[model samples]
Target: MTHSTDSNQTLFERAKALIPGGVNSPVRAFRAVGGTPRFIQRAQGAYMWDANGRRYIDYIGSWGPMILGHGHPAVLEAVQKAALEGFSFGAPTEREVELAEEIIRHVPSMEMIRLVSSGTEAGMSAIRLARGATGRAKIIKFNGCYHGHADSLLVKAGSGLATFGHATSAGVPPEVVQHTLVLEYNDVAQLEEAFALHGKDVACVIMEPIAGNMNFVRAGVPFMRRARELCTQHGALLVIDEVMTGFRVALGGAQSLYAQQIPGFRPDLTVLGKVIGGGMPLAAFGGPRAIMEQLAPLGPVYQAGTLSGNPVATACGLATLREIARPGFYEALAARTRALTDGLTGAAQAAGVDFCADSEGGMFGFFLLPRLPQNYPEVLTTDGARFNRLFHGLLDGGVYIAPALYEAGFVSAAHSAQDVADTVALAREVFGKL
Candidate 1:
């Protein structure tokens, strides 16, 4: 089948003229996949209609916010009701407090919380709070664990351990990242050595408990436990950036999952986004009272947002949370997700393809290799050309996943057994071709 470039091409051309790379985000440009970006018109349930009226079974789930699926009745109703009340007041609202309380009730680690407009703001604020509370300068982060696009967090490590990270993006001065330490994911030895060298100067160690940016790599239990121990021993805070995993991995987020594995394991600060906003631009950072009180109006550190605690966003988030908290919500979602992944892996094996797939709750990823990767460098060894071919093949077959292979795929509660089976059948056909 020859794919036609009609409306989507025209839209991309027009968008490129207006917006940089024809996208607000870099990955949306389809630079890695080499295709014209699809201009989505509308989405309902698990499907999206592109500019040309082409329909697809969306697996991205709006990059992880639409857990209850696109246009869920409850979420829409709450959003519509909130919209009728007002859009933004730039003042306090009762719903914001309610949302905060709901989050705190679910995630016990959050004793005090503050709302923000984006994940970047939440992550940046968490780092600042850590620095202020500890009076330390340096911070540690892991590779492939993206903490938004903050300047300090953008640094990539140099050749050796104990060396400072260099900025990965332009416009970030070298001096800004001098105190930023970037270590390898799942590398407990490196993590220990870094603390040994600069534990006293380190303010916090920020990481994604379950890294979805590098296609759903998880932090090893020992690595996480050691990180928590080292941070505690050094008087540095352990900040878990749950921007992607928050409310998606489980009811209480990745922190809850980690706590089960390592008893009494909770980060000093947690950064949240994605599902928490229910597709709106909302995020938050929270921790214990002692650390949270360092923020201004209560203490010394200063951080504020005009749109912080937005009412409509809060209403949407609250409704989504309530829906997810329903009995058997996660269990059903996980079962369906497992079915999909297992079917896909089995199909690939039957076709004599080298594939490794893993799923947790509603999120999953697969590599065109036999063994699952544990870190960014290992994940980079995936066959990009094969993935691009399979991606386009799946697009031709009516299933939509993230255009980039490095990003994880999501399944919503709306996905049925039929959706999983159909997706697996499509994958079988695609793998056969490969």
Candidate 2:
């Protein structure tokens, strides 16, 4: 098969003249890796076809929402059927209520929830709800765990912000993030210190239970325990941001995974997206009734979206969730992800390359280092130049991973054993060259 990107190059050239950086999202520009960003024409199962009609095994999975893969029959059918019913009511819909019920049934922490159009909206609203409920101003967030592009969240944020190396975006004013204290991802000591200093003033402590933006770093068990205790002791809420991990990690989200490790563990609030939207523009944040009722009609913390809980999006999300909830679905997905990491690790070891990989459920990431990094600063130690080479070599071999090393990759239920084998074979070829 030819690895031609002719049509992709031409489309990108045209896009650059119109769109900023020739992409709607920053990482999609391929600026970090210094290449022509492939203009994806379509995607199905575990494969994507670029504008040049070249096919590549897709690992990005639309950045994580395509856990059932591009166009799963169930999700597509639901979406199509809902579209025919009507697009948007600008009023309440029963399907939205059903989606909420589905989410509440799985996540124990949330007694009430409000659906929004994007992860950023969900995160931003959750912060507002936290501040409003607690009647406090300050909020603590971990450095590498990106909640979204919200002003408070962008402070020392990870993912696209880290890839660009911006301490904070220029457009956001200094006063906006002043109350936002940015701490290290797994530093329990710093967590303790922050609460000790401003315990009374802090409204909440928000973090990704498993930081995906920094390439799959698990918040240390000790650190997680300390965070939960500190938040409770300080009279502050613990908000777990699972926008990337939610249903993708498991039916119950990363919080459930943590619950298994620590007894009776759950966050005061939760933010969700990605898989819940099933590739559509939908996301949500929820918590117990007392805190959640603080938003809208019941209380003063106001948040609203014109297209919140969109009919078609909810249908897609609901279908995807139901399918994944089937017995053995997560077990199979986990095994497939583990197989990919194990294969790559063995190949890298055989080729004498310093490499380490980690996975949980369908999400995974790798670094060209002897071991996985625990935080943003440590994650930075990965050899960027070498990662670029491996990325390009994989791309040439018809396998597509994220353009930047900081981003996490996803494996879909649609990925067969043969697909894993093909990905591993491609990686071995790249490792041999390295």
Tens digits of per-residue lDDT, candidate 1, 62-104, equal 8899999999999999999999999999999999999999999
RMSD of each: 3.4, 1.3
Relative to the true structure, candidate 1 reaches a TM of 0.96
Task: Give per-candidate clash totals.
Answer: 0, 0
Query: Residues 295-328, candidate 2, lDDT per residue (tens digit)?
Result: 8988999999999998999999999899999999
Model 2 gets an lDDT of: 0.92
| Model 2 per-residue lDDT at 298 | 88
Query: Please, what is the whole-model Cα lDDT of each candidate in the order they appear?
Result: 0.88, 0.92
Relative to the unseen true structure, what is the C-alpha lDDT of residue 424 in candidate 2, on a scale of 0 to 100? 93
Pairs with steric clashes in candidate 1 = none
**Each prediction's TM-score versus the true structure:** 0.96, 0.98
10 residues in a row with least lDDT, candidate 2: 1-10
Model 1: how far is 136 from its true place, Å? Answer: 0.5
Q: Name the 10 consecutive residues with the lowest summed lDDT in model 1.
A: 157-166
